[model samples]
Target chain A: MAAVDWGTTRLRVWLVDEAGNVLAERRGDDGLITAQAAGFSTILEGHLAAMGAPEAMPVIVCGMAGSRQGWLEAPYVTVPAPIGAILAGAARVPGQRRDIRIVPGLAQRQADAPDVMRGEETQLAGAGLPAKGRHLVCMPGTHSKWVLVEDSAVTGFGTWPTGELFSVLAAHSILRHSLGEQPQPVASGNPFFQRWCEQALAEGGDVTSRLFSIRAAGLLQDLKPGDAAACLSGLLIGGEIASASRRYGKGGSVVLVASGALSTLYTEALGLAGLAVRAVDADEAVRAGLIEAARKNGMIAGSGVAA
Target chain B: MAAVDWGTTRLRVWLVDEAGNVLAERRGDDGLITAQAAGFSTILEGHLAAMGAPEAMPVIVCGMAGSRQGWLEAPYVTVPAPIGAILAGAARVPGQRRDIRIVPGLAQRQADAPDVMRGEETQLAGAGLPAKGRHLVCMPGTHSKWVLVEDSAVTGFGTWPTGELFSVLAAHSILRHSLGEQPQPVASGNPFFQRWCEQALAEGGDVTSRLFSIRAAGLLQDLKPGDAAACLSGLLIGGEIASASRRYGKGGSVVLVASGALSTLYTEALGLAGLAVRAVDADEAVRAGLIEAARKNGMIAGSGVAA
Candidate 1:
């Protein structure tokens, strides 16, 4: 019995019987970056031993570790490449002790355009939700990925590091002094926040004048630091959404893969845009994706699979 | 006689006699970032010795080196802080046998709306050629500084790291593949460039959709990488200028302190906004700022007095 999901920062594993009954499971800090540096076998050995899984256990690996820079370079499925095709192309870890297979990524090139994505390939396939129409999927994070899916395939997609930029700006800019240690305000549609977004959107935002407003409103006008940071967050996220709409907006369906406060923030903001937002649980999607990958590789029965 | 201009990147010393006649000069790489780590005296020694100047020679400094992180921390001059004031508040390097004075920067504030500047003080002094009405001076670079002044006194200002942002986005993002090199083909005002900017401004980009265009335009539509990069540059700079107008656009003046391609770029863009443009040589301004600073502190002669 085996289950595993690997990302840039965390390593997760699960113990399951042939009937997919979870008797035990374990987790550790075996990320792709570390696994690449420390032998993947050694790290996996420590964790598997903890889970009481034997060396001969069959395990499925996904995420960043499946990339070229990963422990074992999994091949990429080019853009316009089908999700099912990528799942079928999973790479097997060449070791006699353990049965491990790494899922391949996806890529596409049409006309002169080209893009490639790795782990998302499996997640999109495992979504278990049928794709009958055009789908606009927004995956928010450091490098936020927005994908367009049609005919159960990833036709094309774009990525934005909205999360990374937001983090950096919040920490480094003048806004930092005002926004010190406060949680991002909960009011997604706060008036000051909307106004700030409109102001930046209006300026095409070389972002100079409106930025001074951040300091001015705080120093003279007495705008709260949390509100100011929230306002700035609004501008950045708003700017990103505005820029992205040009592409994926053409799609008729919208699904947002997010969780926690971020999901609330994005969904509330999107509500303002008059779009019906369907929020997906991030953790569930990760598991659903892994299970589907294992089934496609013949490691599990596709019939009545449970995640 | 001594004349030197220390900018962010290069150290240029003009060895001169009392008449401002050149005896000999030397050039070296000693931007603030580099000098911040290697002590200021080491950076100064190389130049002074190169010019055959004695350790006791009185050398004045201006620009960023006079900032808090510079060779010595020259204090910040508050808004409405005049050019002469910065010189008067110059900070001297201690322990060196040589007499050294660093010019102070300018500042602006409205109640708690306080912002300060350093290098532009000298640029305005050097451009002493005109101050007829309200004018706007823009110094474009990694951190492009826009200084608004009236009757020769700095009124208010803002900073836009357009160049720096452009550098980071183009060099780091997937967009980098398209932005082959600088001086890209898509001029800021071109139809495609304008459309891209307008869309981003109007729509409020989504991370996925906003960034996807770079790949899409190049991948799906067959747009060139350089042109793509240029379009991105135009969008950012245009957005910045647009943002700046909202704050400082209310009937003042316009001047620019920059050189090379950057100056031309900002000048053309700002021209699109109908603001009058003029430029002050950063190198010369640093020299003049230094001289002015020395005199304010009794290091150099007053206007009529000789060294």
Candidate 2:
């Protein structure tokens, strides 16, 4: 069984033998912006050519590459379903010369607060428990998703444009006057950040107003440039925390699907919002979900489902 | 006396003849960015060339062009007064043959709000007053300023970076994702804009959340992109109006310093704020202020100040 998680910026392909044992894996750029989708075909071909060809090898793919703009349009599955219901929802990707299947992205409520899952459904199936829970799975990125899992079913979820806002404001806003150009990691105990958090918590001030303080702080010697950028970062993330708390916040076992250094920052913010943090490997979840999808569809040997 | 108003992006030099006439004028690229004092040589030379003069002229200069980065490092005069106490502040470009004088900017701190103004002092001086009634001046631009005029002097002011913020978000933010790359005018009285206004008024609702709605509104068939853009503009301006009300609402006489299209927008927003819109010609204000500054220093002959 082979599962591929192809996201905007990165691509990872995993291979499992008949026993579901991980035999090999490869990672490459899947962002497709520069390499185009040609890169994905080349990587898969190289690995298959090196591993020696099997009689039949079925592949399951997911992520942006599955969208209308991706390698092919993968039909989206609506929300509120048991584990197996949506698997039947994926549209087949008719690769010209390769046996390939793509996972469908999900959308709800006309895309306002739409939640999406590219290749993560297989992992949910493997979790075994009913998707039913007051469960909220947070996948943070340029567009952060908060998926509500209930009774082994994919219920409603909210997608906040928080990540994109942070990216643009940090890199492009006039706050850059004080922040300079590059991003600087924020100190954990910075007073400016503390002021930002407390002030936002107390007054729920507009983020724009809060951002202006970066320039003001620098001018008043209240904050240095690096610290000003960090403080702005804190303000943005802190606002995200506050916003998410109110949006996808109802009861549930909160799951944070995070990667890299951002995990700690997000966890800390969640804690600040009084949320108990439990981390999940986002890569593993999506990878696992894709594998189960392949096995369930009989594209891979059923005995290899455990892989 | 000759006065130069050096702004951030452009160097504006007016030749206030001894009779207080703009005998000749010249403009050049930003005086600050070029590292050369356009305020001194090129501008003076241009004026001299235009008027066919070989003698030096006394001038008064203001704006960012006169700041530390400008041709002259004009000191920031504190508020509640019309003119800086210092003599032309620090002249960076002391031309060997030109008798040039630069007007200083203003810096003020009132309780917790601190503000710095450049080039506006010229207008305040031109608006000769009894020093008792309040005059609220709203200067809308990349970084909008709402100045509180008290007794002929600027008591304090609050800065709302609505223009810059709008520009950055519309051009760079994730909001750009939903909007096509093409630039378009915003639709007035559009539903998207109305939604933005509602969001702006929402308790704790930040602009970031409303930003994504641009895409959502346009993509989902309910809102036009132009209208979505307009809503964003409206939301930002609305938010600014709210902030300004809190900071400088004590005034009975509110004055708006804008002209042309921006003036109309500002007028619409002021109407939304339930304030009587009184438009002041910005160019005339600058001229009046320059003339008054020249007259006060006995450099030019007439009052020539208009309200």
Candidate 3:
């Protein structure tokens, strides 16, 4: 069986043996845009062939490939949708010789706060959350999602444009002058980052009033561009944590599904807000999710079930 | 007498008679950058000459011209310094034929929330708030400043980058796709704007969580580009109001120093937040401020004072 995470800008695939051990792996920029232009079948099959994958190995796909503009629209399964329902709701790509199923994303259609997520749902399914009780899951990205799950069902979630806001403000806003062209990396331990994060949390996530202070600090105190960048990162991330905490309550540990730099930042921010972090690698979670979808869709045999 | 508002990217000069009536006006792109290249004296003299003003007429300048990088560094008068200090601290631009002065800006150097304002201090002086009470002055612009005035002294102020945030998000963020290249103007009566503003206020200015919903709503509900732009505006303005209210308490009517489209939008948002707005035209306020600076510096005689 082959598991593929086909997002908007990147694609990754892994071949697994019957025992669930990885046999081969491939990654590329052949995401939705490339696949749409080159043809999804051409791209997928080419990658499979290059990895020397078996001709009959069915593929379990997720992410933007399931979006309306992608290869085939895997219509969203609205929440409080059961975890198993998502795996079962896989939309099979028609006319393909091999069984190719794309996992459906989740949609919250609340009138006031309509939201939809494609790839992150697969990551959620693979996060291996507890079967019972309420859990708060934090998935930080360009658009971060704070999801609430109860009894293995997604109850509700909120999305924050923290990452995108930071990008735009740094690159395009007046703060650009203070931040310089390319800002230095902001580590979790950066004092400026921690302090600003704490301040945002203390102020109940009201950061707009404090943003201009960064530029002023640069002008008046000669604050370094690197520190200014760190302050921004802290303010945004801190604001996100504060809002999510208020919306969903600071309940125990947050299942932080992220990797690398973002992971470090969020972990630090969450801890500052008095929330413990249960870290999970995003890549592993998505792959596990695809594998689960494959098994549930009967493309692969469950461990205790007969093939 | 000549009053000049020399900001970062714009320069405006008003020729005023002894009676404080404008005789003529000249506006140009001779701001800090241009003035730096083509000597400030030359730019001022050229504008003055074009206005047919007397060669010996004294000039009173404000805004970025007072900054260290400007023509003459009119060092910031630290708060809670009285309005009189700012007027008296005017830095004289030496080596000029005329007695040219630049009004000093106000600086809040509290290590935790350091802030500075150049042109706005003049506006505050001209706003004509009650001399005894603690007044909250809301000046909306690219970097919107909410100032606290007690007696004739500026206690403190905070700057919210509301306009700049809206501009960058519309032009550079993923929301740009939903908002279009050029969104229709968002008026005060836009329902989408009102609703989002109300929501942000209710949520205690926690708008970071709601930011992505604008993008999601566009994807799911086929929200119009104009409505999307309105939603962004509402969220930012609403958040600013909410935060400022928390920081400075929703006291009596807020002194709203703004004009044009911004004045309309802010007036509506402030009403939604249940605060009365004492509307003041920004142009008139700044001009009045410059006049006040001129009178205090004796470049122009006070109505009651001897020449």
Candidate 4:
């Protein structure tokens, strides 16, 4: 069996043995945006061939590939929904050479606070839902998701455009003058980043006002470009945590599903925000989720009965 | 005499008679950013000549023209300081054909909440500081200033990057997909705008999270381009007002120093937030500010003592 996490800008695939051990893996730039124009089936076949996967191997997919503009629309499953239900509601690609199932995303249709998530749902499932007590999950990315899980069900969730906002402001806004043209990675241990995180957490609600302080600090206090970049990251991540904590209720421990640089930054920020976080590798979680979905759909042999 | 508002992206010069009445006006794209390389003196001279001003006319300039990168660094007048003191601290351009004075901006030097504003001080001086009472002034622009004025002095203020955020998000972020290429002015009475404004005011502090909803709403509810644009505007403005009101204390009536479309949008949003707003034309206020600065500096004859 094979698993794939296909998003807007990147694609990751893994070939797994019957016991769910990863035998091989491959990554590509052929995300939904690129693959949509140049055939999804072709892209998937090429990637599978590159990984040397068998032609009859069953594949499980997640993320934007199931979006309306992708190969086929996998309509959103509304919350308070069980994570396992996503696998049960998976949409299979029609007229395919092999069995390919795409996990459905989640939607919060509350009129006042409507939100949707594509790839993060799989991350949540892979993180393992809390069985007895409620849990708060923070998945940081281009669109960060704050999920509330109670007794293995996702009660509600919110999305924060922190990453996107930071990118756009750092590149396009006047703050770009302070933050140089090149995208510099903010160091998690930078004091400037820590100070800004504390400041943002303290001034929780006034993000817009605090954002201007970056420029003011740059202009008036001679804040260095690298520090400015770190400050920006801290402020955005800290503010997201503050707001998410408030909105979702900060009662339980937060499960942070992330990887690489983002994971480090978010872990530091959550710690600064004074929350205990259980870290999970996002890549592994997504793959585990795909494997679980495949097993539930009977595309792969498993003893578990439809989750 | 002439009054000039030389900002980063625009230049506006108004020829005024001794009685403080505008005789002629000229506007150009050569702001401090553009004029810095093009020669500030040459640009000013051309505008003055276009407005048919006399060679000996003393010009009172405000805004970015006073920045370090401007004609000459006017330096910052620290607060809690009187607005009229700006005239006294003005930086004069030496070795020029005409007497050109640039009013200094105000800076809050506090290490925790450092903030700075250039042109708005002149507007405050022109608007005539509240006599024997406290006033909250909202100057909406690229960097909107929410100033707290008491007994003719600016005690403290905050800057919200609402306008810049809106522009960047509308033009560069994922929201741009729904908002089209050309920026559309949000209608004040748009229901989507009003609803989002009310929601933002209610939610108040979660701007980053709410921003993502704009994209989600567009995706799930099929929100149109115009409505999406309006919704974005409402969320930003409402969030700004909410945070500003909280930080500045929502006791006094808000003095909305804005003009045209922004004024209308702000006024309506403020009204929705259940705050009484005293609308002051921003153009007239800035002009009056420049005129007052000129008079106080003894460049023009006036009987009125500096407020």
Q: Between 1 and 4, whose DockQ is larger?
A: 4
Task: Estimate TM-scores for all models.
Answer: 0.66, 0.80, 0.96, 0.97
Error of 4 at B235 (Å): 0.4
Worst-scoring 10-residue span by lDDT in model 3 chain B: B298-307
The DockQ values of the predictions, listed in order, are: 0.20, 0.29, 0.79, 0.76
Give me candidate 1's interface root-mean-square deviation.
Answer: 5.8
Name the best candidate (by TM-score).
4
Question: Where's the lowest-lDDT run of ten residues in candidate 1 chain A?
Answer: A200-209
Ranking by lDDT: 3, 4, 1, 2
Angstrom error at residue B21, model 3 = 0.6
Model 1 gets an lDDT of 0.65
Q: Could you tell me the lDDT of residue A223 within candidate 3?
A: 91
**Predicted candidate 4 versus true structure: per-residue lDDT over A157-180, tens digit per residue:** 999888988899999998898898
lDDT of 1 by residue, A8-77 (tens): 7778887766555666767777788788888777877788887778767788878878766677888766
Residue-wise C-alpha lDDT for candidate 3, range B1-307, written one tens digit per residue: 9999999899999999887799998899989989889988898899999999897999999999888889989898888877766776788888888989999998898888989999999988888887788889999988899999888889999998888888888889888998999987798699999999999988777778888899889888889999999999999999999989998997467999998999999999999999988999988888888888888877788832211
Could you tell me how far off, in angstroms, the CA of residue B101 lies in candidate 4 after the best superposition? 0.8
Residue pair clashes in candidate 4: none
User: Where does model 3 exceed 4 Å of error?
Assistant: A303-307, B303-307
Best by DockQ: 3
